[model samples]
Target: MADETPGFELPLLLFAGFRTLIDQLHAELARQGHPDVRPAYGFALQAIGRGGATASELGRLLGVSKQAAGKTVDRLVALGYAVRADDPADARRKVIRLTPHGVDALARSAAIFEELRAQWATALGPGRLRALEADLRAVAPLAGVRLDVPGWFGG
Candidate 1:
C-alpha cells in the first residue's frame, strides 16, 4: 500500500529518483561481472584519474575525516583498482592512482551511464530531460551540498 501523502517535497523526490538510477547502475555493473565495485569506488577512481591525490587530500575533497578516506583507499587497494605509492617530492606521503583495470572499469561505467541517460530521454522526452538538466544546473549551487565521494555528482 502506498502512503497517501498530501504533497511530495521536490528535494526528497529528486533524491529518490537519483537513488533509483544509482541502483540500476549498480545492477548493471554486477550483471557485467564487476566485483565489489561500488559507486564510491567509481568516485574515487575519478578523483585519482584526474590527478593523483593523497588520502588526506581525498578526505578533504570528499568532506570526510582522514580516517574514513583511508578506509576507502584500503578497499580500492584490496579490489586491485588503485595503488598507493610514495610521492616523489615527499616520500613520507603516499599518493593514490588508478590502475589500468580501474581506468577500463570507469570507461565501461561511463558507457553504461550514457545508455541509462538515453533510456531516460526515451522515457521523458528530450525536451523534458533538457529542462530537468537546466533546472538542476540552476539550482545545484543553491543547495550547498558537499561531496562525500570524490567525483560523485560533479564534485
Candidate 2:
C-alpha cells in the first residue's frame, strides 16, 4: 500500500518492519543477560566485526551522527567489547575492530538472532517468511535500496 499523501511505498514499510524486528531481537538479547546489547551496539559490533573501518565509517554505516556514533563506541569500549587502533593507511584516524571479547559477544548475539528468526518462522510459517524475504529482495535493486547492513549495505 502506498501512502496517500507522502507517497510511502512497500520498501519503506518493509524497512520499518525489518528495523522493528532488529529492535525486538536486541531487546530479547539484552533480557537474556546481555544488558549492554542494543540496536546501535549491534551496528557497531558488526562494523568492527568486519575489520578495518574507522569510527566515522561506522557512524555512517549506523546512520547515526558522528558524535552519537563515537558515544556508542565509547560505551562498547568501556564494556571491553571493542577497541580503537591507529589506522595503518591514515595515521590521523583510528580504525575500530572487535576484541576477542567482542567477537565472543557477537557470537552470542548471533545465536540470539538465529533463535528469534526460528521463532518468527514458527509463528509465520517458514514458507511465508521466505516468500516475504524474497519479495523484498526482488524489488531492492530497482529501488536503489540495499537492506544488507554489512559494510555500507554490502556496496
Candidate 3:
C-alpha cells in the first residue's frame, strides 16, 4: 500500500525510513558504550578504515570542505580515534589511520549494525526486506546517491 499523501515520491519515503533507522541506530550505539561518536564520525571511521587517506581525500569522500574535514580530523585525533602521520610516499603529505581503540570501536559499531539489520529483517520479514534492498540497490545509481556515506542524511 502506498503512503497517505497523494503523489508522495519514493525518495521522500526512503528518506524518512533512513532517517528513522539512523536515529535509532545512533541511540543504540550510545547505549552500547559509544556515546562520543556521532553519525558523521562513523563515516570518517569508515573512510579511514579503508586503508588510509589524506585530509584532502577525506574531504572529497565526506563531501565537505577541506576546512570542515580538517576540523573533523582534529576532533578524531583529539579523541584518540585517529592519528595524523606523514605519508610515506610523500613526506609533505599526511594520512589518517585509526588507532587500536578506533579499530575496536569500528568493530563494535559493525556488530551493532548487523544486529540492527537482523532486527529489521525480523520485523519486515525476510522476503520483503530482501526485495526492498534489491529495489533500493537498483534505483540507487539512478538517484546519484553515494552508498558509503551513512551520515549523509544526518549531517
What would the TM-scores of all predictions be?
0.83, 0.70, 0.83
Regions more than 4 Å wrong, model 1: 1-8, 141-146, 149-155
**Model 3 TM:** 0.83
Q: Give one digit per residue, the lDDT tens place, for model 3 in 1-155.
A: 86687566766887788777778778887787767887788888887885888888888888786787889999999988899999999999999999886887788888877887888899999899999888878867556755346335447
RMSD of 1: 4.9
Cα RMSD for predicted model 2: 5.3
lDDT of 1 at 132: 90
Q: Write the per-residue lDDT of candidate 1 for residues 1-155, one digit (tens) a residue.
A: 88676466776888888888888888888787676898777666766774689998888767666887889899998888889999999999999988877777888788889999999999999999989988888878635655554445434
Q: State the weakest 10-residue window (summed lDDT) of model 2.
A: 146-155
List ranges where model 3 is wrong by over 4 Å. 1-5, 141-155
What global local distance difference test value does model 2 have? 0.74
**Each candidate's lDDT (Cα)?**
0.80, 0.74, 0.81
lDDT of 2 by residue, 39-103 (tens): 65776787667574676777776666678678888898898888889888979998888887788
lDDT of 3 at 65: 68
Report per-prediction Cα RMSD to one decimal: 4.9, 5.3, 3.2
lDDT of 3 at 26: 80
Error of 2 at 93 (Å): 3.1
- Deviation (Å) of 35 in candidate 3: 0.8
Query: Could you tell me the TM-score of candidate 2?
Result: 0.70
Output the lDDT of residue 76, model 3: 92
